[model samples]
Structures are given as C-alpha cells and as structure tokens.
Target: MTGLHERHLAVSPDWLALYYRHPLELTHGEGRHVWDADGNRYLDFFGGILTTMTAHALPEVTKAVSEQAGRIIHSSTLYLNRPMVELAERVAALSGIPDARVFFTTSGTEANDTALLLATAHRGSNQILAMRNSYHGRSFSAVSITGNRSWSTTSLSPLQTLYVHGGVRTRGPYAELSDERFIKACVADLEDLLGHTRGVAALIAEPVQGVGGFTAPPDGLYAAFREVLDRHGILWISDEVQTGWGRTGDHFWGWQAHASSGPPDILTFAKGIGNGMSIGGVVARADVMNCLDANSISTFGGSPVTMAAGLANLSYLLEHDLQGNARRVGGLLIERLRAVGAGSPAVREVRGRGLMIGIELVRPGTDEADPDRAAAVLEAARAGGLLIGKGGGHNTSVLRIAPPLSLTVAEAEEGAEILGQALHTAT
Candidate 1:
C-alpha cells in the first residue's frame, strides 16, 4: 500500500505546512484527546488551529449534521433556507452591532474577502491599513493584506495596503513602554499615517493576530484607533477568525476588549462556528452590509447541512455556557503553562488569554528567537504524547496552544506535565 506521506507529497502543494518531523495521522478524537492512525492517544493542544471550537466529534454537532442531511442537505441562497436564517439571526445578535446583517461563506478566507469588498466599496477606496504582524487569511486579497512575509506569497494585489504599528506588543520599537504609553504611541502613529495617506478605506486587524503568534496590542488600543478612524470617516474591520465565539474567554468577541464607541463596521469569523463543518461568515451594520448594489448569491455558503451544524454547535456552546468554561479552564491552563516555563531559558514569553496561548522561544539568556529549539520542543512533546503547534513572525519560534473550549482541568494538568518534560529535554 502507498504510504500516506508519499501520497500527500505527490498531491499536496509544497507550501502546505505539516507539524512534527514525523507527522501523525489523527484518526479520531473525543473531548481534548485524539488518537493517531496507530492508535496512540495524545492530548490535542492546538485543536486544528482552533477550528474545533467545542470538542472533537461533539455529539450535538454530529446529530445536527446527520438530521439535516436526512431531511435535505442544501438549497441555494436564492431560496429561503430556515437553518441559514436561524444561524444568521443568532450570529447577528451576538455580533454586538446594531441592526447587523450576516452573510455566510464557505471559509474564513471568503468571509474576509467579502469584508474587504464591503469596506472598499462602502468607503469608495481601494486602500487598506493593516498591522505589521497581522494575518487575515490565505486568499489573494487576504494574503495581500497579511503583514507576515512568510504567509504573503506575492507582491501583486488588487488593493494598496499600508502597514501599521503595534500589532505585536513585545519586541517592537515601543516594546519597553508602559501599557498606557504603548496605546497612546500606537494611536499617534495611526493618526500620523492617516495624515500622509489618501483614500484609506479602513483599518483591518486581527484582535489576537492568530498566525502572527497570538500577539495582541494593549486592551484598548483599537478603541483609541476607533476614535481616530471616526474622525477620518474610516471603517474598522475586525478579523475574528481565531478570536470569535468566546474563544478569548473574557469577552464574546475579541473586539469587546477594545470597544469604545461601538462594534466594528465589519466582523469576519470562521474556524469554529460549525464545530468542524466548513462555515465562515461576516456580520456588519445594516448600512455597510447593504452597500453592495449588485445581486449576490452563495451556492454553498450556508447550505442547510453546515448551517444546521452551526446552529446546533452554537446552541450547545451557549447552553453549556462554554464561554464561562473557557474563562475558568483557560485561566488555570495559562498559569500552569507559565509555571512550566518559569525556569526554561529558551522560553522567552508565555502570552495569550482564554484558550489561545503562545510560548515564544528564544536563545538561552538572549532575545534572539530560536526556531530550531521550538521545533525540537514540538516534536519532543509529540514523543511525550502531547501534540502542539508552532508559529511566529520571528522565524516561527512561537509555540501555540488553543485547545477546545471544553478543556478540562485534568487534561490541562496532563498536557502541562508532558510539555514541561518536553521543554526541559528540548532546551
């Protein structure tokens, strides 16, 4: 039989990243644990890059998908769809925008693309402002705005993007400032840039900068920017693909931490709403959402199957108060991981909130990032029966941990124990 590795190499793109020196094929999962093709059980820390919002193979989501499939899987957006309407209503209510309208897509990339279109069209400008370490998605427009060179594949883009400061709090020019000073400095920088630029459609940002190693600005940085943008009649678009649906613990949406006047003009989300089904969407105010004049349709955007799955998954999350669960469990997990990293010289910083956490690895006793050491820790953790992820703009030297919202205390301890061992051995 052909090996999985050989088969993938023959078909998958070379840029497709895989974890570990020897990747394990996960066959199944339950709660926070997953089993490999060889039946080896391991604690899943990353949750498919935070896609599994609830738990693996969650019964509620599964039942909803099957039941919907039994009835009828899909009908184009041109027709009235009950499940889509229900999911849309729920998302709009949670979006924190008044008179919000929701538009579903097949993936986060599409959701972001739709948002960019709306912002540029509504503001009548093709110019966008993006953060230095922010990542929106992988589509052409998304990549064009992505600040990480490793993720941005080309210089060709339909929109002209201007880079901004203060996405990554530490290791930047203003890293040494107090939190209050940092916010003030970033706001001043944005104001300065706006004065020099023209046709600035909006400032698009990731509240947590997911692929940029989960880094975020001070709590109210965006709030200050909101004030400046409002003066210039610019829009704000929060790319919440990794920070939405209560993943951040303290707030339902990541922007809530930075909210001053109101919610963003547009919000894009994906990765967890369907709990595994491919469902992405954008929520915006009525005026902004209705800015487009031409007719539009999405054949697979909110197909009954995925919408049913999303409705069920969201219901389960709210009913169980998983947001509260993420707050409590993620708080404990962060403290545990911080304790584990306390003595490790290679561990530069441990940061993040809720279930989304990042451990930046650097040379022992120095500030230089150590990608090699980070990779070694990842593989060592796998050997120790715990699977994690690595990412960063600094040569990809950050260890990312974003388990499902339902992560239990016991699993957190177990994963921390193994991770501690892995860090010690690898360092």
Candidate 2:
C-alpha cells in the first residue's frame, strides 16, 4: 500500500470505505475530469457521489466562497445573516410547498432529522413509514428510517420506523407487474399496512433511491400512495438529497413527477445545492415548520461562505440551464450504456433518469447479483482512466453513473466507451 493509504487506514475508521484496491489520491479536478497524485487524469463519472452538481472547480461558486470568506465566514445564527436569508428565500420560493419555510442544516442527515422532529411534533406521533432499500443518511435518526440493511448500523432508534414496498422497481414482489398495476399494488399494500397501524407521523421516501442502486418505482406510485396517506392525514416527506435541484432532468424536483398529488408536505435537500459546499436544508409548510415548540437553530448551518457558494452555484445552474443539459446529455449516455450492456451477460439492468444511471450486474444467465464482477468493473474502469461508483441494496452489484450536470455529449460518449471496455475486460 502507498504511504498515504497506510496513513489513511491508520487514522480513518475501518467502516469508512475507499474505492479502488490501491486508492488513487485525486490531486485536483476541472470540469468533468480529475487528476491523481500520479498526474494521471480520469473522467469523473460519480461527481463525488452527486455532490458536484455544476462541475468541478466551478468558477462562480469558488469566487462566491472566496469573496464571502474575505468578508465573513460565519457569524452564528444569533444575528441576521443576509446570505442565509437570501438563500432561504430562494429555496423557499423554488420549493413548491405552499407557505414554505426553509431551515438550513450542515448535512442531509441533519436535514432529515429536523424533518422527523417536525413531523413527529406536528402529528403527535413517533411512527414513520420508510421504503424498502431506501437510504436517507448516516445519523442515528436518519439510519432509523433507512431501510437498507447494509447502511443501518444499529437496531436501536428513537422513532418507530416501518419499512414499506415500492422504492425499488425490480427484484420485488411487484416487479413483474405493469407500471399501472405496480402503482396499484403498491398503493394497496400501503393501505393495508396503514390499516393495522395508527398515528403515523409521516411517510419519507426518495423519488429515486440513490444508495439503493438508483432503483425507483413507477412514476406515479408515490402519487397513489399520497391518496392513501391523505386519508390518514400522514405528512409526506420527500428526501431529495440525491434527486433534488434538477438532477432528475425532466422535473426540477423528483416529487414533481408525482404532481397529481400536489407537493410533498416536507422536502429535504443537500448534495449539489452548493456544488461541493456543505449545505443541507428542509423546506416545509409554514405550519409544520412552526410546529416545533422550542426554538431551534443551526450554529454552522447557512454560514456566509456556504450560503454564498449556494447562491452563486444555484444561479449558475439556473442560468446555464444545466437541467436541460442533463436531459440531453444524460439521454445520450443512458442509451449508449444500454447499448454497451446489451452484449454483456453480467449486466442485468441499466436504468435511471437524467444523469443518475445505474447498471445492475448479475451472474451470467442467473438472477443472482454479481457484486464481485461489479467491483472488478469499477477497478477496470479506473485503470482505463474513467472513474465510477457502485451501490446496491443487494451487495453493491450496481454501477452508479452520476456525472456532473454540465457534462458534454462528447464526455458522455467517451465515458460510455471506457465503461464498455471495462465491462468487457472485467466481466
């Protein structure tokens, strides 16, 4: 192992995983590419797990952070902060929730924690409904609602969380059903689940399950669930940490795909709003937000530097119409990857929307997941000067591809070619 790797292993927690067998230290990044400490450049397909929304080293966000830091990095939440208020106003306006109130946090975990606090307090219930194979975050409360066994570290939790169906479209009891029927079955299952329970605080779900290997149900499944939830007066919390801010392409927010049910009662977002800056927040209806009895404040949330980065990053994203770019480029990339997967026996599925795509690997002619083959492909891709990510509810057998929203068509094609070669050689 490299000296740096040895040192990292010595200092970092064993549970904290690294990518390649011989981890490459990335020295710097520009646009869609990054260079290793060896000065070898590789195309970045994962975008730091979808946190680099616009691009690497985006000038606008860097300048904003630099300028803001020159003035004031933070002043705590006790005083009136202009950048925080400005960012909150922008987010609240963009969030479809009527009379929305935005509360900033440092990470998606904290954001979801706040959401749970709001829902439980507002409804006077500690019960929450989460989707199977769903991953929200890593905190105690976040893990409580996370249904992914690989991610949940402990069984002990503060809230009663019940796992539900339909987060994953395939490998489930309803996978064989048609989209319409799938929605119907999921709704029926939800209704049945709720019939046996009472005083549920909320139903939290990701429109596209990110760490669950980008699996998702039919577009309107959540809308159908909304009908059942409304009957119980259960608030819906959309965990948009991975699917928010136009990452899904067709819609500004993933929840919009289920617009027939109107906006979610609460929406939490992180990853990508500030590009690489640490920024997370929850947007809820005014009543739900104000429902908290005691005053709550985030000391480092919405700090001047991060808020400035968020504002500039958001502005650049909107101005450049990166959403449209993601749609066009992502469409080309998925089709190219589907073509690549067509001849590979190891590939069981290639599915996603926008820049968020996943290629599920399986044993040849078998339904069983091939996590070993997936890891091999990841290493081979890196050796071939392409970087990608892997995730799955079933042993991390899925190749996750979430490039920057500003990816060019040429970059997508290049990435596909490299990925094809990696799959061919490795699997």
Candidate 3:
C-alpha cells in the first residue's frame, strides 16, 4: 500500500471499504473524468456512487459555493437562512406530494431516519415493510429496514421491519411469473404479510434498489402494494436516494413508474442534487410532516453554503434539461451494454434504467454468483482507465454503471468498449 493508504488503514474503521488494490486518491475531477493522486486520468463511471449528479466541479455550483462561503459558511437552524428557505421552497414544490414540507439533513441515512420518525409517529406504529434486496442507508433504523443481508449489520433497531419479495425479477420465487402475474403475486404476499403483523406504519422501498444491485420490481408492482396499504391506512415511503431527479430517465421520481397509486406519502432524497455538496432531505405532506409534536432541528442541515450549492445545481439541471439527456444517452448506453453482455456466459443478467445500469456476474452456466470475477472486472476496468462500482443483493457480483448526467455519446461508447474488454479479460 502507498503511504496514504497505509495511514488510512491505520486510522479508519475496519469496516470502511475502499475500491481497487491500490486505493487511489482522487485529486481532481471535471465533467466525466478524474485524475488520481498519481495523476492518472480515468473515466468515472460510478460518479462517487451517483453523488456527483451533474458533473464534477460544475462551474455554476462551484461559484455559488465559493460566493456563499465568502458571505457565511453556516448559520444554525435557529435563523431564517435565505438560501435554505429557497432550496426548501423549490424542493417542496417539486416533491410531487400535496402541500409538501421539506426537512433537510446532511446525508441519506439521516433523511431516512427522519422519515421513519415521521412515519412511526403519524401512524402510531413501529412496524415497517421493506422489500427484499432493498438498501436504504447506514444508520440503526435505516440498516434495520434494509433487506439486503450483505449490507445490514444488525437486527437491533427501534422499528420492527418485515422483509417482502419481488424486488429482483430474475432470482426470486416469482421470477417465472408474467409481469401481470408477478404484480398480483407480490400484492398478495404484501397482503399476507400485513395481515400477520399488528399494523405497519409505512412501507419503505427503493424503486431501483441501489446497493442491492439496481434490482427492481416491474412497474406498477408498488402501485398494487399501494392499493393494499391504503386499505390499512399504512403510509408508503419511496427511498429515492438513487432514483430521484430523473436519474431513472423514464420518470422524475422513481415512484412515478407506479404513478397509478399517486405520489408516496413520504420521499427521502440524498445523493446528487447538490452535485458534490452533502445534501439530503425528506418531503412529506403537511399532515405527516406535522405529526411530530416535539421540536426537532438538524444542526448542520440546510446551511447557507450547501443550500447555495443546491440552488445552483438544481437550476443548472432544470435549465439544461439533464433529465432528457439521461433518457436519450442512457437508452443508448443500456443497449450497448446488453449487446456486449450477450456473448458472455458469465453475465446472468443486464438490467437497470437510465444511467444506472447493472451487469450481474455468475459462474458460467451456473446459478452461483461470481464475486471473484466481479472483483477481477473491477480491477481490470481500473487498469484500462475506467472506473466502475460493484454491488449485489445475492452477492457482490453486479457491476454498477452510473456516470454523470452530462456524459457525452463518445464517452459512453468508450466506457462500453473498456467494460466489454474488461469483462472478457476477467473470465
């Protein structure tokens, strides 16, 4: 290991994971490319797990952040920060929830934690419904509700969580069912689950399960579940940490795929939005948001600097129509990846929507997940000057591809070529 890597290992928590054998330190980034401490340039396909939404060091966001920093870095939540209020206003209007209220946090974990708080308080139930292979965040409550065993660290939590099925279409009990049948079966299963519990406060899910390998149920599955949840007065929470802000292309919010059921009662968003600045929040209708009786505030949330960054980032995204860009470019990228994966026996499935794509690796002609090959592919991709990510609910055997929304056609083609070569080499 390098000197910096050695120091990091000595000081950091053992559970803190780093990518690649050498563990590169990213020195700088612009658009879709980043340079390591060693000055090696590589195409950044993962975009720091999709946190860098628009682009690295976007001029608009950078200027806004710099200008805000000059004025004031932070003012505690006690004051009426103009930038904070502006950001909150924009987010509330776009939240899709009626009469929405927005509460800011520093990360997705805290966002979900707040969502859980609101949910349990409003419904007077600590029971939560989570999808199998779904991943939320990394806090006590968030981890408890996560259905992926690979990510969940403990069973101890304040809320009681029940795991539901139908997140992964190709590897579950209802895999063979037709789309219509699949929806019906999942709804029935949800009904059965609810009946067994005293009462569920909310059903939290990721429309595209991020750390669960971008696995997702067919569209309308959640809508069907919404139908059942409504009868019981249970709230639905969409964890849009990964699928929000048009990252999924076809819809603005991931739940829009299930629009038949209407917007979720509560929605949690983090990752992206402020570009690289830490920004997260929960949006809910006035009733659910106001349910909490006690006073609460996020000390570092919605500070002037971060709020300015968010406003600039959001304006750039909407003005440029990056959502449409994601739709057009992402459509081409998925097709290219599918064609590349077709000839590889190790590839069990190629799935996902928009810029978020996943290639599931398996033992050739076998059902077993091949995490070793996935690791090999990751290393090879890095060596080839391309950076990707790995994740899976079954195992860490899915290659995650999520580049910046501003990726050009040439960059997408180049990434595909490198990935195709890396996949074959890993075999």
Candidate 4:
C-alpha cells in the first residue's frame, strides 16, 4: 500500500470505506476531471458524493473563499455576518416555504438533526415517519430516521421512527404494479401505518434516495402522501442533501417533482450549496422555526468563508444555467448508458432523472444483487481513468453516476465509453 493509504487505514475508522482495491488520493482537480497523487487524471463522475455541484476548482467560488478568508473566517453566530445573512436570504427565497426561516449548520447530519429538533419541538412529539430504503445523514438523530439497514448501524434511537414503504419502485412488493397503483398502495400503507401511531412530528424523506442507490418512487408518490400527512397535522420534511440545487436536473429541488402538493413543511439541504465548503441548512415556515422556546446557535454553521463560497457557487450555478446543462447532457448520457447496459446480462436497470443516475448489477439471469461484481466494476472503471461510486439498499450492488452539473456532452460521452468498457471487463 502507499504510505498515505497505510496512514489512512491506521487513523480512519474501520467502517469508513474507501473506493477501489487500492484507494486513490486525489491531489487536485479542474472542470470535470481530478488527478491522483501519482499524477493520473480521471473523470470524476461521482463528484465527491455529489458535493462538487458546479465544477472542480471553480474560479468564482475560489475567489470568494479567498477574499472572505482574508477578511474574516468566522465570527460565530453572536456577531452580524453579512455573507451569512445574504446566503440565507437567497436560500429562503428559493426554499418555497411561506414566510421561511433559515438555520445554517456545518454538515448535512447537523442540518437534519436541527430539522428533527425543530419538527419534534413544533409538534410536541418525538415520533417520526420515514421512508424505507431512505438515508438522511449520519448523526444520532439522522440515523434514527434512516431506514436503510446497511447504513442504520444501531437500533437505539432518541425518537420513535416508523419506517413506511414506497421509496424503491423496482425491488419491493409493489414493483409489478403500475405507477398509479404504486402511488395508491404507498398512500394506503402510509394511512394504515398512521392509524397505529399518534402525534407524529414529521415525515422525513429524500425525493431521490441517495445512499439507497439513486432509487426513487413515482413522481407523485410524495404528493399523495402529503394529503394524508396534512390530515394528521404531520410536518413533511424533505431531505435534499443529494437531490437539491438542480443536481436532479429536471427540477431545481427534487420536491418540485411532487409539486401537486406544493412544498414540504421543512426542507434540509447540504452537500453542494457551497460546492466543496461545509454548508448545510434547514428552511422552515417562520412559525415552525420560532416554535423553539430556547435560543440555539451553530458555531461553525454559517462561517463567513463558507457562506461566501455558497453565494459564489449559487451565483455561478444560476448565471451559467448549469441545471440546463445537466438536463441536456444527462439525457444523452443516460441514453448512451442504457444502450450499453442492454447487452450486459448482469445489468438490471439504468435509472434516474437528470444528472443523478444508477445502474444496478445482479447475477446473470437472476434477481440476486451482485455486490462483488459492482466492486469489480468500480475497480475496473478507475483502471480506465474514470471515478464512479456504488450504493444499494441491502448491498452495494448499484453503480452510481452523479457528475457535476456543469458536465459537457463530450465529457459525458467519454465517461460513458470508459464505463461501458469497465462494466464489460469487470464482468
């Protein structure tokens, strides 16, 4: 192993997984490509788990961070922070919550934790409803609401979490049902589950299940659930950590796909807003936000440097219309990938909207997941100068492709070609 790899193994937790048989140490990046410490360049399809929203080494974001660092790195939440306020304003305006209030955090875990806090306090209940095969974050509270067995490490939790169905449309019992019937069944399941509970604070879900291998329900599944949650006075919390800020391409926010019910009562976002900086936040109705009787603050949540990066990143994303690029290029990439998958017996599905895509791997002519093959494909892809990621519900059997929103058509096609070779070689 390399010296850095040996050192990482010594210092990192056993559960902190790394990609490839020999993990790579990326030294620097530009545009859609990154270079390893050994001077090999690769197309970064996973975007560091979708955190690099715009592109690698974006000049606008770098300049903002540098300028802000020169002035002030952080003043805590005690002092007036202009950049924090400005970024919050932009986020609030876009959050779609009426009379919205925004609270910043340092990571997606903290953001979800704050959302759960707000939700339970507002409703005076510690009961939460979550979708099966869903992943929110990695905090104690966040994990409590998580339904993915692979990610939910412990059974003990602070809240009473009820796992509902309908996150994955392709593997569950409802897979054979039509889209309309699937929505109806999930809604019925939700209503039935609620009949056995009381004082549910909120229903937290990802419009697109990220760690669950990019799986999603029918477009209106959440909209259908919204009607039931409203009757029970339960808040709907949309965890947009992976699907937020135009990453999904077709919509600025993934929740917009279920626009029939309007916005959620609360929305939590992270990963991409600040490009690579640490920035996560919760947006809620003013009344729900103020429901907390005690004052709370995040020390490193809205640091000036991070907020400046977020503002610059957001400006660049909007001005350049990266979302449009994601739609156009991602469409072609998915089509190309689907064509490639058509000939592979191990390939089960190529699914997603916009830039977020997943390719499931299974044993040839069988329904069983092939996590071993998935890992091999990951290694092969890296060997071919492409960096992708993997995730699934019960096992790591799906290849995830979520490049930066600014990916060009040429880059997409090149990456697809490399990936096709990887899939075949690994098989």
lDDT of 4 by residue, 306-342 (tens): 9999999999999999889889999999999999999
Alpha-carbon lDDT of model 4: 0.94
Off by over 4 Å in 4: none
- Candidate 2 C-alpha lDDT tens digits along 1-427: 9999999999999999999899989999999999999999999999889999999999999999999999998888998999999999999999989999999999998999999999999999999999999999998999999898889999999999998999988888999999998888888889889989999999999999999999988888889899899989999999999999998899999999999999999999999997889999999999999998888777999899999999999999999999999889999999999999998999999999999999999999999999999999999999899999999999999999999999999999999999999999997
Instruction: Report per-prediction Cα RMSD to one decimal.
Output: 1.1, 0.7, 0.7, 0.7
lDDT of 3 by residue, 222-332 (tens): 999998999999999999999999998888889999999999999999989878889999999999999989998778999899999999999998899888888999999
Pairs with steric clashes in candidate 1: none
Who is ahead in TM-score, 1 or 4? 4
Off by over 4 Å in 2: none
Instruction: Say which prediction, candidate 1 or candidate 2, comes out ahead on TM-score.
Output: 2
- Looking at model 1, which ten-residue stretch has the lowest summed lDDT? 1-10
Deviation in Å, model 4, residue 88 alpha carbon: 0.7
| TM-scores for candidates 1 onward, in order | 0.98, 0.99, 0.99, 0.99
Q: Is candidate 1 or candidate 3 better by lDDT?
A: 3
Candidate no. 1 TM-score: 0.98
In terms of lDDT, model 1 sits at 0.92
lDDT scores of the candidates, listed in order: 0.92, 0.94, 0.93, 0.94
Clashes of each: 0, 0, 0, 0
lDDT, residue 156, candidate 2: 95
Question: For residue 330, what is the lDDT in candidate 4?
Answer: 90
